[model samples]
Target: MKERMEKRVLVLNLDHTPVGIVNVQKALVLTFLEKATSLVHFDYLEIRTVDRIFPYPAVIRLYEYKNIPYKGVMLNRNNLFKRDQHTCQYCGGDKRLTLDHVIPRSKGGKSSWKNLVTACHRCNTLKGDKTPEQAGMTLRTLPFRPTLSYFLAEYAERHAAEWLPFLEVKPVG
Candidate 1:
């Protein structure tokens, strides 16, 4: 039960902008060290050790503001699939997916967000080593870097809905 409660915790920067997710144990350690404070607890959940009882933290904020240097999300295969929601940018196919360069690398297109996209094996093979334009394919959407808030919000999704207000950056109806 204790281990289960220690599984996840949302961590926020001093500005109240979410930075990432951490385990509840890490959150507790931060709170103990005066490095962070709990913002809220999950309903009907508590952590009890031999010494005392404590509320199970759902969200926590750091005491000091760290620049975190704006090095955005990594440019990698898994991130590409996640950014595109596992759908082929071309033809919208959903199986045997692979990465495709919008402007083929052979033509000097760097492996960056703007140049990369998710594509099913069929589309990838059909348009091998050529620009999508040359292969007569159309991208469903242009790929770009997701905002930090949006990226962290995706991680918060596995937690409680109460986290929505804390992670909220963009307007929602």
Candidate 2:
């Protein structure tokens, strides 16, 4: 039962904007509490208890609009690599990935999106504690902060085909 229920559920704000994705359990809890309503249900799935069966929702919408604080995506290894498409920003190589400071921290570069790039181990060593200009290397792309919707779109892949209407996600080709 637990294994069957462990799926991603798309969550939307009151005005139908994508806010986040929650686990099925959280979606069920929200719907049961009347704080959210099921906007889309999974294809050909249901929750079966001892004596009752319930429709399993794939997308849920909040009854009230909650003002969430503005915070961009977290700074982490996985996300940094994702932003650069797992390729070295300096050499465009997709092997032995690592994070490199565009402007080395030793040179007062803050570790924000704009200042970081994915690097191969070779490039990382080559650019050690030096700006790309000083190291005679060039960055392939400028990184920017990813929005919540970007992560939300990635989460959409785990849901049922019936969820296409509610989430602003298109299938990745």
Candidate 3:
């Protein structure tokens, strides 16, 4: 049987950094209803309740008034893999992609995004039951939670192209 796709939400930094991803259904409601906003690379794009309205970037920055660290959330696999662009974390190879556990289950790894990574079978077996140091492997990028904006951007680009303008971002070229 085909597996069900897990849903995700978007995570936004107070500074509007697309720090990580969240479940989709939650993000949709947040964005569509103006309860939440989208975080682009540099700023938070506000969701307008009324037509033709735009959010002021200055207002969002003023509201935060503090520097905050990065945050993230769980997202779907397709989206996760896409965010990683199907590159294997172990060797940076892009073929025979598979999910890997940074920390093995025997070592108390949970089946979660922060613990999981995209890898090739060779890397998976090589790194099995041992930490990266023990296995002589190093991650190209540290695994962390994804921002909601990343998920939304991915979702809209692939699933709802029409929403791009409403999102106030250029369509993926």
- The TM-score of candidate 2 is 0.75
lDDT at 31, model 2? 95
TM-score attained by model 3: 0.49
Query: Best-fitting candidate, measured by lDDT?
Result: 1
lDDT of each: 0.83, 0.80, 0.58
**Tens digit of per-residue lDDT, candidate 1, span 124-151:** 9999988888899899988887666665
RMSD over all Cα atoms, model 3 = 10.5
Residue-level lDDT for 12 in candidate 2: 86
TM-scores for all candidates?
0.81, 0.75, 0.49
Alpha carbon lDDT of residue 66, candidate 3?
A: 38
Per-residue C-alpha lDDT of model 2 across residues 11-63, encoded as one tens digit per residue: 88898777787888899999999999998887677898799988988889999
Tens-place lDDT digits, model 3, residues 1-173: 01111323335445444334444445555556765654432133333445664432211111232355535445566655776769988898888877887888899988876787888888888898898988999998877666555456667677444334334242221
Top TM-score model: 1
